[model samples]
Target chain A: MLTEILHTLPQVLLDGLTLGAVYAIVALGYTMVYGILELINFAHGEIFMTGAFIGTAIFLTMTGLGVMSAMPALLALILVLVVTSVLTGVLGMGIERVAYRPLRKAPKLITLITAIGVSFLLQDLVRFIAELKKGNYIITGPSLFTNQVTVEASSLFSTFNNAQLKSSSIILIVTAIIMMFALDFFINRTKWGMAMRAVAQDRETAALMSVNVNKVISLTFFVGSALGGATGVLFAVQYGTIDPYIGFILGLKAFTAAVLGGIGNIRGAMFGGVLLGLLEMFAAANLSILSGGVLGGEYKDVFAFAILILVLIFKPEGIFGKAVTEKV
Target chain B: MNLLEVRNISLAFGGVKALNDVSFTIRKGEIFSLIGPNGAGKTSMLNCISGLYRPTEGSISFEGADITGMKPFKRAGLGIARAFQNIELFSHLTVLDNLMLGRHTKMKTGVLAGGFYWGRAQKEEIEHRKAVERVIDFLEIEDIRNIPVGRLAYGLKKRVEVGRALAMEPKLLLLDEPMAGMNAEEKEDMARFILDIHEEMGSTVVLIEHDMGVVMDLSDSVAVLDFGKLIGKGTPQEVQENPDVIKAYLGEEQFI
Candidate 1:
């Protein structure tokens, strides 16, 4: 029994890492936009979906037009990434401008409801548009990067096969790492980043410092949306298929990751995503023991949510979150 | 010539006049005080000047430029900074981080340069860090520099809030009830800080304060407000002797 558990350990670890990376990417969109605007961009999940659809559409179109060769595929993938990122980024900004900007000084509950409304609106719009052109429930696209380069398992771990690690997962993880580092640098080093942090800390004070609060808020929405777009594309590539409803569960999980990491803390989101992913994998692997049932295949989500609840109950600020205090 | 000029400013909230045709001017390097009883429109006037609230009538000009309809941030870009009556420090951030946020407007590196951490961005960040550090040291908050502002004491938090506004290096600084709710010792410390900020920095100050003694001691010019109207404006002694100023406080005492 121990050997069986040991044999599956590495695979669980791999699964966790992949899941965590995806959650981390999507959680960044939630955390960052939340940090700046102090409002949850409810439509962020839909934006992720939009990105997947855009990327899938672009890749399939390129393939149909005879641009499926390696070099051309790489170029087309880059084009798709850029276009999809811009489209989703703009969509994010539009949501902010139309749904959130005017309600800047409104009550928090009003804005929250508006955000929910926008989320449903985007979901319906995407569903309607997708229904018009699709016969298949899942849209399949050509792989943009699928060359498998396996790392051989050492003699000590002879039973394990490195071939199980997909090139797409590796690429996604690397991209996520690069994006996270880039985001950290942007937040810490750039002028606009400073403005964003300032606005987040105190909007009135930020304005008093001559930082254009509106422009900073808009830029925040754009960057957050762009990150969501990247995550969507990555998800599509990893799974080899894009479905309109892909964002629903992913969004909830990512949001859970954000809360786990500490909503307003960027570094927290990254760590939380990776940690949540690992936990989900471990639960999936040991479901029989955890659930005490013969069929434990579908308990991954239950386990993930269980972790979320436990964290909230014990460490509400999340693992890395700083406690907030008010001065009288 | 005055650096900040207010002309016939009036504001109303649902038929209640917060300010009625109020006018004032502040020159560079001057310590000006706006003193009034509670609900006498001191905060409303400051809000109007800071662009947080629009005046129902009249105009505001800074450095020979009309800023009546400009956004609060735009007004800030023209060298305006203010501290809130209720401390609004970013609770989760360190004192140094709060100060660094104050330097946001002065930073020059764009997102592209920031993303890569290239030459210009690095230089800019280092320079701003140095400036923020200076403010921290000046405020004598060096020990708590890395500690989150939320955990600081009320006095220290107020100091940090002042430090944040100072980091802006504004041409004009507005303090809303700087010593409100403070004990005598805290009030003295805050007063000294305010004086140092004015004398050493040579930035113009427009403060709204309720403490009569502190207001009289700190202000070079004093404006008195009684129910949204300018009852008196002159030296501290002049306002003290004004019968209308006495009546405003007298009426409040009787009602209470």
Candidate 2:
């Protein structure tokens, strides 16, 4: 059983990194909106789903137009990502303007309920558009970056097996890293970023400083949704098959990662995401063997939730969250 | 030079009058004080001027433009800066950042340039830093420039709040109790700062303060409010001599 665990570890790490990068990008969307507006942006998952379908739709069109054949897969993927992100960002802003902004003066609970309403609305809206266009809601986008490479680790160690990695996985991980660095730079070094932090600290005071609070909030949604949409394209390029429902579970898990890292901290969300992905993959690979066949790989979600509950009980501020301190 | 003209500003909240037909004019380059009992609509009048609260009736003209319906940020852009009675500094921000943010209206880097740190963003930041460093020098907060505002002592925090407003380079400065809850030393330091701000910076100041000594000493003009109505408007000595002002405020031994 130990050798079995050792043999599968390389492949698990490969898979875990790919999954973690996705969760990290998506968790960024949750954390950014939550940081500025104190809104959870419950429709974020649906926006992710919408981005996936839109990306697939764009790819299907590109393939039909023969653009995919003429251009490199990487270039086509980039094109799809840009277009899909812009569209979803606009959609996010529209949702904020029409659905959220009107209720700005309303109670907090009422605004949250409207967010749920927006989530359901986006899900159904995407559902019918997808079904009408494809005659089926489920889609498998045209393949790209299909090259697979194998690492020869068994030559050095007897217990370790060779790991297989897809070219798309490399692209996904690199893109995620580049995007994270760019966002970090944008937040820490820019005037807009300083204004964002100030607004998050105090909206009324921020306005007194001449920071346009509404414009900042709108731009935040645009950027957050844009990142979510871009990640959807990456997700589609890697996994190849998607549906309207993929966002619900994935978004919940990403939210878990956000909570695990401290919801409002950007770097914390990234760390939380990668950690959760590695832990979940580890459990998937080892749970059945360790449990003596009583528990299977399907209980991996249970294991993830167990981590969340434990964190809630023991370290509710999360790994990176600051504990509330009342001065003595 | 009348810098701010408040014409019959009345504000009511669901059948409760917070300010009623209160009107006053602030001249350029002088310290003006608003003295009132508790719940006497002093802060409410400032709110109306600063665009935080819209008066139910009347208009406010600043720098000769009617700013009665202007948004708060737009008001800030028109050279009106205010410090809060309660500290409103960004606690998570360092003292330098808190001051830099005060100059936000003057910094014009677009989001794309800001994100890319491309041409003009770097130059803009450097220029703004130079401008902000002047504020730090003027306020003498150079030592605490890198420390977060939340960790500062309360007196220092109040000073930084005024520093933030001064960073705006406002033609009119609205100070809501810059000396409240301070020791004699802190209050004297703040009064000296206010004097320097008026004498050197040459900005009009509108002050709301509870300490009669500070109000009497610092004010070129004093407006007395009671039950949301302005009862007297004159120099501090004249306001002290007015029968209505004496009967309403000074007669109370606790107030004096």
Candidate 3:
């Protein structure tokens, strides 16, 4: 049993990392929006799903025209990322303007209900469009990065087996890292970022600082949604299939990641995302063996939520939880 | 000409009147203090001037232009800056960053430019940092520039609050109870600092202070309010001698 665990450890970590990268990126949207507004944007997952659909559609069109495959994969990847990010960013801002902004002064519970409503609205809207176009809502997009690579861990250690992943996994990780670092720099060092921190702390006082509160709120939506949207594109490409409903479950998990790391802490969310991903993957590989077949891989999600419940019970502040109410 | 002209401003929430037909003028580069007992509408009048409360009846003109309906942020842009009665500093941020936030309106870097954070953005940031540093130097808070405000002593936090307003380089400064919770020594220090900010910065100051000693010593002009009504307005000495001001403070009773 020990040998079996060792043999699969490397493979699990590799696969887990790829999935974790997506979670960390998507969790950012939840954290960023929650930092300022304190409202869990339920539509965020839908935004990610929309990005996946849009990314796939654009990828299909580019390939259909015989251009996407002809371009370098990196350039092609960037093009999709930028286009989808802007579209989803705008959608997020529009969501805030039409749905969240009007209800901002209303009760928080009302805003939350409205968010769930928007989430359902987006799911149905995307479903209708996808079904009209392809006759099915679930899509299998053409792989832009299909090359596979295997890490030869067995050569270095006798018990460890080799781990394999497609070339898209590398792209996903590098992109996620770059995006994460960029966001970190923006929040910490930039003028607008400072203003964001101020507004998050005290909205009325921030206005007294001459920080345009409305514009700052709008920009927050744009950046957070843009990150989620781009992650959706990364998700569809790596997984090779997507549907409008993918966001609901994935978003809940990503939200779990956000809460596990302190909800408003940016760096905490990133660490939480990667940690959750690795844990989930590990559970999937070892749960049956560890439980003596009492549980199967199907219990991975339950394991994740159990951890959330435990954290909420024991350390409700979070894993790295300080007084994170105002920290950027 | 007066720097700020409040023309018959009245603010009412439903049936409760916070301010009623309150009018006053603040001259440029002078310290104008508003004094009254509690609920005298002194703070309400300040809120109206700062554009936090839109007076239901009248208009406010700053620098000779009407700003009655402008937003609070817009008023800040027009050189109106205020420190709250409570220390409203961003508690999580360092004192330097809190002061830097005062330069928010002066900054022009957009999201993309900010995200890049090099070249022009770096230069723009440093320039603003220099301005904030000057404020730090003047406030003598150089030692605590990097300290988080939430951890600071109460007196120091109050100074940082005023320093934040000073960083804006405002043409008109509004201070609401800047020395509300200070000890005698701290109050004396704040009073000196307030005078220095007025004299050296050349900024018009509108002060709301409960300390009569500080108000009498600091204000070039004084306005007394009772129940949202401006009962008297004159120099500190004249206001102190007025029958209306005496009645408002002494409650129409004989005093030794």
Per residue, candidate 3 scores C-alpha lDDT tens digits across B140-224 of: 9999999999999999999999999999999999999999989999999999999999999999998999999999999999999
Q: Per-residue lDDT for B1-256 in model 1, tens only?
A: 6999999999999999999999988887899999889999999999998999999899999998999999998887777888989987877678988888778778877766776778988888899999998898888899999998879898889899889989989889999988878889999989998999998888899999988888899998999898899999998999889888988876635444
lDDT at position A283, candidate 1: 80
What DockQ does each prediction reach against the true complex?
A: 0.57, 0.79, 0.86
Residue pairs that clash (backbone atoms under 3 angstroms), model 2? none
Cα TM-score per model: 0.88, 0.96, 0.97
Better of 1 and 2 by TM-score: 2
What pairs collide in candidate 1? none
Q: Which candidate is the best by lDDT?
A: 3
Task: Give per-residue lDDT, candidate 3, residue B222.
Answer: 95
| Descending-lDDT candidate ranking | 3, 2, 1
The true-versus-predicted C-alpha distance at residue A326 of model 3, in Å, is 14
Q: How far is B145's C-alpha from truth in model 3 (Å)?
A: 0.8
Instruction: Give the alpha carbon lDDT tens digit for every residue of B167-243 in model 2.
Output: 98999999999998999999999999999999989999999999999999999999999999999999999999988
- Candidate 1 B-chain TM-score: 0.96
**Each candidate's clash count:** 0, 0, 0
